[model samples]
Target chain A: MREDASISINEIQEQIIREMARLDDWMEKYEYLIDLGRDLPPMETALRRDEYSIAGCQSQVWLMPRMRDGRMNYVADSDAKITRGIIALVLRVLNNQPPRDIAAAELYFLDRTGLRSNLSPSRANGLAAIVKQMKAAAAARMNT
Target chain B: MVFTGTTYKKINTAQVLDVDKVRKDFPILARRVNGRPLIYLDNAATCQKPRAVVKRIVDFYTRNNSNIHRGVHALSERASGEFEAARETVRQFLNARSTREIVFTQGTTDAINLVADSFGADFLSKGDEIIVSGMEHHSNVLPWQRICARRQAALKVLPCEHNGRLRVEDLDRLITENTKLIALVYVSNVLGVRNPVEEVIRRARARGVPVLLDGAQAVAHFEVDVRALDCDFFAFSGHKLYADTGIGVLYGKEQWLRILPPYRTGGGMVQSVGPERVRYAGLPLKFEAGTMHVAGALSLEEAIHYLRKLGFDSVRAHQRRLMDYAEGRLRALDGVTVYASPSRRYGAVSFTIDGVHPYDAGLILDKLGIAVRSGTHCAEPLMRKYGVGGMVRASFALYNTRDEVDALIEGIRRVQELCGECKSTRSLQ
Candidate 1:
């Protein structure tokens, strides 16, 4: 799939939901996620420090955000593959989008993929934290 | 199905538990998680409550619900009688000298905090030392840490061995004249190793230092005789013993409870309160303040009765078989590291798989309807000592079976396979 700036956040989310719908069971869905996580570009080692880490996650997650040409770009990584995969999915929808779009975007694709359970606040898997951090970062950029 | 009257008699006669029969008593066991039969291996977190316990709670709320120790009416007197009777049950359960020794609290954490606050305030002074083990759950560690900070006392630690044993031999050097209290876990929640607490208690006694055993993990697996152990203090949670949450026991010696001032003060805990000064109530009531968890206490009593009916011999034997099978099966698997494979283990077996994070394994296991605990299991210091971020723990209970262990083993293999495929396919990509 091309990283097209022309695609809207909802369109990408729909695309993700449609892609996830093709998987028959949780195993296949997880496998697809694992592949996505494995393919994600590694975050710069210097940026993966304690300051970038999210608290309350069972796995160690580091999320770093940058603004490029009035758009948000997030570089995130997790020690756990499943969490990394979940973050990869989140970034797929929001990455390179305008800060306003990123901030206001509703992540319905996570629920559609049957992966929302992992994003529960009680689960503390870092997906929820990642999404919150991404939006908060975008909102912060909008003020500047 | 209420295991109240005749069912007790039936269970007492049977030497070993009918495992299936025992499993039936816990309603949650029959339910499915995800799409498969639930394999609950997280008993160390909290055991499933039996029907008798639930019924006891409901029965109390339905009929004998009233403020205890205050009311002169029929319901109040009945409620107070049953509440004190629950204390007596706990007293008998731990074989304490009197009901005076059994003080109720919210749970193990609350009990420990009670002791730390009361005892530390009364006994500890600047430069006085308190000893705790490296493997203690944060509950055991944090209370003493706070108290020590307040008292300006030193907190000494008995380091855990590489193989997961507390270094008991170091107690002589650690237990100086300045040592006020030695708090330790009776069972390691992470390693499953039952610490050599008896020897530590004996050694501490000789040195005139009081010892507190955090028996939160111990009480559920075996019988605890406070008199036999001769420890100054023992703390355990009711929920871990198949009873309700929000109730626990802090068994103190008569001498200790007599001197340790009240932890919380309120309406129920006072003999009289005047404008100028106040007089505290005696013994157990001094510690129990306000309207207690009357239902929780009553349910705990029923849970004890239920356990006594099943018999500790049976519980021990069954748990032993499951642990042995689980340890054997887990040890057989390649690329798995079982922490603290001590000669004596109880309740939980914690480990990690190579190239697979414990969190990921837990996620997959949850999907398969096999519940497990991952991450540090609330013992981060121990995890740091072992040089791991987290571990997968499968903790067993009386209702848990060899079949569940088999399921856990299979589930672990599935985790390894799924995570392994991700790596292999990634290498190809």
Candidate 2:
């Protein structure tokens, strides 16, 4: 978890949008996202249980959450590269944030950057499922 | 493009029907998508409706739109007549013994559930086995699973080869005294392989077990005769046959329809509901509860008529040519791997490319105005068997053209070029 950094979800979302906007084409943007996925930290094999998996995703995605210093820290991975990329974008906004902030945060960067509409129905569904699982994990930790 | 030689002619033996004329029937085919001409190769999902079917639906809504079988009004009588006439069309389409055997449901899924629920409730008992192929779609498998769970019956799978062909030779060992029914897919939507349903049916008949064939993919391209097949039950959806989405047909033998209870008991399915006791309506009507999709049934009849006009011989020939072209194109691609080289395959052609996800391939194809189906295709078990996450499937119909197949090839090449860097140079083996 990056304890030194504390940026609002909106600011992080804008940063992502700005980075994505630098790319001229959809292919370039997708390639950048795939690279981000490749560079993202791999989830621990021990944490990859079925309970942590998100349903309704076209790809098999696992999300494991941990409470580190009152903030929700998540580790995620997916079988498909594009899905992994989408999940990486999702994790960037919500990871290492306070449980309440994570749960309440409306991650609108995907829609603002035109990623949501440009995505195929199943891809959009996979992204939504990942977001839902992340929020649910945050909410669960908050409750506990 | 040189389609010369007897081999080509032998493959498409049916007289060359005017494809350009057939293409004109579908208005949507002329339109463009994503700045490119729309090349629809997703026929396995649902076929595009011709002008005839569309005009029939519009005409029904404009003139004779009324609830069937209840009212005394002229519109109701006309609608009732049309709906029953549609039933007769389906009866003739499948060459069923009688109209009394045909029951309309929401679609193939609904039809399968009707049989699985009603038949399982009536006949299935504890420890009884319902045999289904591994290649069966979730629709055919899930309903039976639910019913088996409820009735303490076991749902046994008839295993298929890695290429998705079921081994009917193992039928002797698989079917036991406890086996009640054998359910199979007449044509696999994924592999596009026509299963040895006749052999399976003969085997089941020997064991005195009734067989149910999911003919959702078969009815459009092949000549489906329920009487000739002698299968106990056959189910298919209208949408895949170029008809409306919400309409489907379930054809059961009279003996079984009489023996099995009603799937859903309601107003239309009752003889007389008195205070003391109620008697169910006979045969087909007993299965069709409440208000049916009257307009959909009529439109389905039009779709059937359109298909009949084209004739199955030309339709089959056209489909075979498309599949052959598609298979050849896919096999020629460096990274592309075609799945299930079944002997008697038609219509659908599924493949995977190195270092590209099926969804990614499908997305790129969509951008190029080539629509194809990606992912498990409702056959998750088959995916698991093949050890692939998902596959991109480009299916054909009578309406699909050689030019469209060329566009699909170009689209795939574009996908490869775009995602080339991301692809690992590792061996697939």
Candidate 3:
């Protein structure tokens, strides 16, 4: 089994929305975020060049989102497989959702995926960076 | 199904590798997995034990188990004899000059860390280069990286090609006089690419740079003759070789090991301890810091013997056939992508499906009773180079069969259907 199977897609948006709401300390929701990663569709490999890369991830990450039927459909890859899973979790709730909805995702899906319990603080920070990227993508989509 | 015709001929020709006789040796292969017969394809991760090896371990604990070298008692003598005898078996297996060249550790990771902490840190000053390939497992890559960070050595990487193969030229470009160590993985855990270690080692030797091989995946799939390969240092895990864990082999050129510092210093390794200073023991003893994994060493001997009896040529051909069969079947699937060609293939075949994420695929496969590995495979750089974040890896061994591959193919098809027609996601090339 993939070591990163801690999260599921269905829970990604829900966790993020809840975390935003601060229903529980975001610190308590690490596993949920990890689980959200479990179902992330990997970024397609064709975009592995320097342009699509996510900087500062312990493993390199490349994210590319396309507009399909006015919703965001993402193709992402990571030097770290688990990080790609994390990307999938972030994209599930944030992608192609309305800009306001994307920006305002009220749930911290990390809780639902049980991510907070097992991961390190650095990983937690990495998760936050990915979340920030997704939010940025959503905001850009909204403006577009 | 996962069946490959090459795998069939391999199993059939070795007729000695009969599924029934071979299957009997492995205790776990007989059991049910996920309610069906277990089809373990995770051999690259760790092989299940044969009764011969497992029975040896049980017998040691029941009959002659004791701390080795320290006690002059009968039990310690027997254990020490058996443990060191195991080292002799390994010495013959890898064809080293002496058993003293082999030092036991927790596993491959520890062995690599030993090289890093001992020789790597001591010799590699800042600005010196340590060349590694993109396909390294964290075990091989991380240690040198850490040691380089400490010693101010530069870490250089050799890129893998579309075929996932590393060329000699890439190594040529990466190596310079400043290249103190060139560490490469023997078999890629994810992409199944086999590096040209002999050529790499020969080339590096001429240049005065030491070469280390992470043989964790290769040792299980091929006949590893360290003297034949002539690598400076070789490391592998016992678990991957069908022996128990908590033990591994780190083989260095005896002359080289003599000069390098020890990895960990403690009671057993120390000949005598002055309050502020300690003198270390000799050879393998100097490296073993505590009471040894006596049983682990003994069982490792059994595992090596089992492989010798099995014969390397038959096993290699058998596993290659299985890989071809499985790769062909996986290729037939809609939206499935399998990388690394047969010419360069090891027992491992790593690929991805269009619609199913690797984890979901793993989950569904688990439910189907077929065991495989998924995710980055601790090879992030290699994964990134391939434009994938992760993949599902199905690796075989001497005991695996065409029928098991069939089960794997069917399970994959089941997951693919569940995820729906995913042509949009497909990339077989």
Candidate whose DockQ is highest: 1
lDDT (C-alpha) at residue B174 in model 3: 78
lDDT of 2 at B312: 70
**Per-residue lDDT of model 2, residues A25-103, tens digit only:** 6666666666767767878778778888764435667887788988888888876666677778888888778898888
* Per-model i-RMS: 3.0, 6.1, 11.5
Docking class of 3: incorrect
Better of 1 and 2 by TM-score: 1
TM-score of each: 0.95, 0.91, 0.75
TM-score-best of 1 and 3: 1
**DockQ leaderboard ranking:** 1, 2, 3
Measured with C-alpha atoms, the lDDT of residue A110 in candidate 3 is 59
Tens-digit per-residue lDDT, A46-79, candidate 3: 7776766655423455666566655556666554
Q: What TM value does model 2 have?
A: 0.91
Error of 2 at B93 (Å): 0.9
Predictions in order: lDDT: 0.89, 0.84, 0.75
